[model samples]
Target: MKATIPVYDICTVSDGHQHPDLLTERLGSYLKENYQRVHQQHGHSFYHLVLFTGGSGSHTLDFTRYAVEPWQLYFMTPGQVHSWHLGPETEGYVVHFSTAFFRSFLANPDYLDRFPFFSGQSPDQVMEVPEKLRDAIQSVFEQILQAGADNEPDLVRALLLQLFLETDRHIARDGEPGVPQQKQLVLRNFMALINRHYRSLRLPREYAEQLYITPNHLNALCQDLLGKTAGEIIRERVLLEAKRLLTNEQKTVAEIAGELNFPDNSYFSRFFRKYVGQSPEEFRKSLN
Candidate 1:
């Protein structure tokens, strides 16, 4: 098999100059002109968010299909597989930016990852704008639209930060009651650590050590909030990466196993099959 899925870059030029590592556009015109690119199964190398003010449809991200509606906000981190199908009337605002787009101005480069919508968990990445805040959020996107058109990178970025913060604030207010703030921070930090080290640290104790919590406390935290063991959390991340890597049809099974740091192809296949109910090749074949 050869590589089939396209990974898009944040490369665009406006007028006679190359635009910075960001792109913003109206969803209607964007899909109208780039129908195939938006509809096809592909990945992007930038952070993406879309606010749907009208239309009905569904979007698939990382193999999970999410039913979309008006006043819905969807965000995707780089490298996640994506595709969508919607009626012609669907319209919204889309903003795409690379890591450098924000990191250059902020001291902390991974600040956006703190938002649950940017967590890369398929379900977590989709948020429905509350009725009262819909208009406010729409106003922000409109400002973003104008800023993008004016080529005001600084103003656009400020609006982007505002949007992210507003969304995060709402999510926090809507979260389950009784989850302590400290516990929430610890869980998020654990997730951040997992995202950075899943390729090497596959043990609950290892993560517990880094988090300054005992293994039992970490496991209890996972079960209380996420309904899984800390070990399972780490393993699920590894499995997700396995699925993502298998999407690259150019890679052989052995090569993928090596890249994932598995001892051998057989070990990787067994692990994948145990959880996924099929071998990696079968999973990949099903996608095609």
Candidate 2:
């Protein structure tokens, strides 16, 4: 069976107020309670930005695990899997939005260049949301909440825009321009290509050809900035998606192998085991 990219919808919360939107407030409550209850819970689909204002927790985010503490922020991008083990009496605010929300903003050609935060940087790029900044975020959420229920869409859009701006502010305060401007652009384009076509294109040279550069050059840049060879990066991306489909959805191994463009089920199984240390079926069973 040929594999198909599953259809999934982006989740958004809209309100027409200037105060903290009800959705954020409600989600914050749920996160506070659940973070405490399930020593750990896995997130599927939508991206979440969680601000840990109090208490502590352990979070394994996208192959990297970290301890969550007060005044710290963590970002979970769409398609990245995460499991969190909450500390006792955790308190925080969580903002959930879909890729659709980001698309509306990134439709502008210069958006990604202006904001490097979306670029796949190390997870440690997260910074503390300062006290004044937190107050401002609270104000925006509160405004959205206060707005009468009549204009939900407008309120939600406003709050989302404010949130994005606040995130940019935090990034600006914390991020050091470690990568050169030209290299950053190259790396950004490389990531965009992989994110869109990782299933079909498996070789670093393929990406190099598309970028009009030598494979050796591309590997050099990737190693210098991302600390990984081009092949390693590509494999990581492919395996990440494979894991998502196998565990989150009811897809058969043969179907997934076909979608990933393997020549045969046996080849795909061997490839998966080589990188993941287990067969696809074994990994899926472990998730269950």
Candidate 3:
């Protein structure tokens, strides 16, 4: 298979200019006169929060496609591959911000790891925004766009936080209720650790050890919250990266296996097939 999915940083789409720490724009305009690029699978170095206020379509993250409608919101974290196909009438607000912008807002480097929406543990990435709340969210996005013109980074940062806070409230209200906070914390920590060490560590026990929890405890937490064992969660992360590499990078299967720390190509092939339902080469070919 050819390398069809390229990982793009903000600069790559901005005429080779450096990406601003935070930026906002109308979704339709940002995609420009030709909107087909939005349908191409790609990865980003920045986080994306897109709110659609008109029309309908679908957005795919990893291998799952999500339905999108007016007044719906979607979040995409850095390193996740996503693509969209929205109707031509679609109108929305899009906010793009870097990791540095988020880190500057809070002392904790992993502050974003706590968000339930884009985190790997969450299955639902799209949230239905209440009609009453749309105006407020729109105002915040407009403020961020205007703040950019004034070159006020601090103002943009503050408004961005407000937007996120409001979105969080809506998500919490609409999401599954009565999930214990302790279970949420364990899942969050597990996702954070996976993001940090997915390439070298493939074992659930490794993550459990670092979190100072027993392996069984970690597995139980995952089973309760995500309906999967801790090891399955780890493999899910690994499989995501494996698919990304197979589709984006030019490396052969064996080389990719070695880079991902698999002992041999066969071992990697078996693991990939077990979770993804196809051999690595077959998966790559199917992408064509």
Candidate 4:
């Protein structure tokens, strides 16, 4: 049998949604029905953000574990892998939304991408809500919950944006040194490119050529904002996908190599060993 990961959409988790684009609910109620799946490794077809006002456990996103603590907020873009453990008393607010959620409401379709937490990088996806701002953020989530119950998509959308804006203001506040808008734009484009073409175009120069920038300039942009060279970013993406596939036990190592378009299984094994510090089979065994 071919192994695959579970990828959920709005309807799969909830029903009777007049607004199919967004769903907000108390995390406890959600867990009452979804506890099993929530603990299993899976991906979502929509953006998922949760604020833990009261929780004790952990959330694992793309293989990185984050402690579940009060006032912690986590974000996930579409297609990212996530799972969690929870205490019986765990409670919070969770909002699941689709790309279409804001595209119709705002003039800019990519506006949500501007927020750092929504970047889907595991490190950037988890955050501790600032000490003083916890109450206000909690209130905003309450408002969103009420709006969601009323099936008011517009209000829900606006409040979500407000929540993001308020959180980003304080969270990224260390004067985030006003990176040039152009540089930010380029970085976003580069990341998008990497996601779209990492399997085939593994070279930074190839991306630079597409962006009409030199390889050095591309590396500088990545280094300045992301603390990694452009090439490393591309390789990280490839490795992430490889790991995701490896999580599916039915797939053989050579099959994964072929799926990733590696020239041969030996080359793929070498690459995995060089970075992952173990053979693919060893990694799979560790998971077991």
Report the poorest 10 consecutive residues by lDDT, candidate 4: 168-177
lDDT of 1 by residue, 1-40 (tens): 5666888877731123235677788888777877888787
Deviation in angstroms for 155 in model 3?
Answer: 1.5
Off by over 4 Å in 1: 12-18, 172-177
Model 2 TM-score, 2 decimals:
0.73
lDDT value for candidate 3?
0.76
After TM-score superposition, the amount by which residue 69's alpha carbon in candidate 2 deviates from its true location, in angstroms, is 1.5
Better of 1 and 3 by lDDT: 1
The digit string of per-residue lDDT tens for model 3 on 1-288 reads 365477776655544223356656787887674366678888888888888888777888877888878888778888788788887788888877777886756888776666766575326556787878878877887888788667777888788777766776566432346877677677777887887798888788999999999999999888877788988878887888888788765788999899899999999999999878899999988866
Best by TM-score: 1
Candidate 3 residue runs with Cα over 4 Å from true position: 1-4, 15-19, 33-36, 103-105, 120-124, 172-176
CA lDDT of each prediction against the hidden true structure: 0.84, 0.64, 0.76, 0.84
Question: Considering lDDT, which of the candidate structures 3 and 4 is the better prediction for this target?
Answer: 4
- Give lDDT tens digits, candidate 2, residues 122-190: 353356667777777666656654442444655666676666667765544323356576786687788
Worst 10 residues of 2 by lDDT: 12-21
Distance from true location, Cα of 232 in model 3, Å: 1.2
Model 4: residue 48 alpha-carbon error in angstroms? 0.7
Query: Where does model 2 exceed 4 Å of error?
Result: 1-22, 26-28, 32-44, 102-106, 109-175
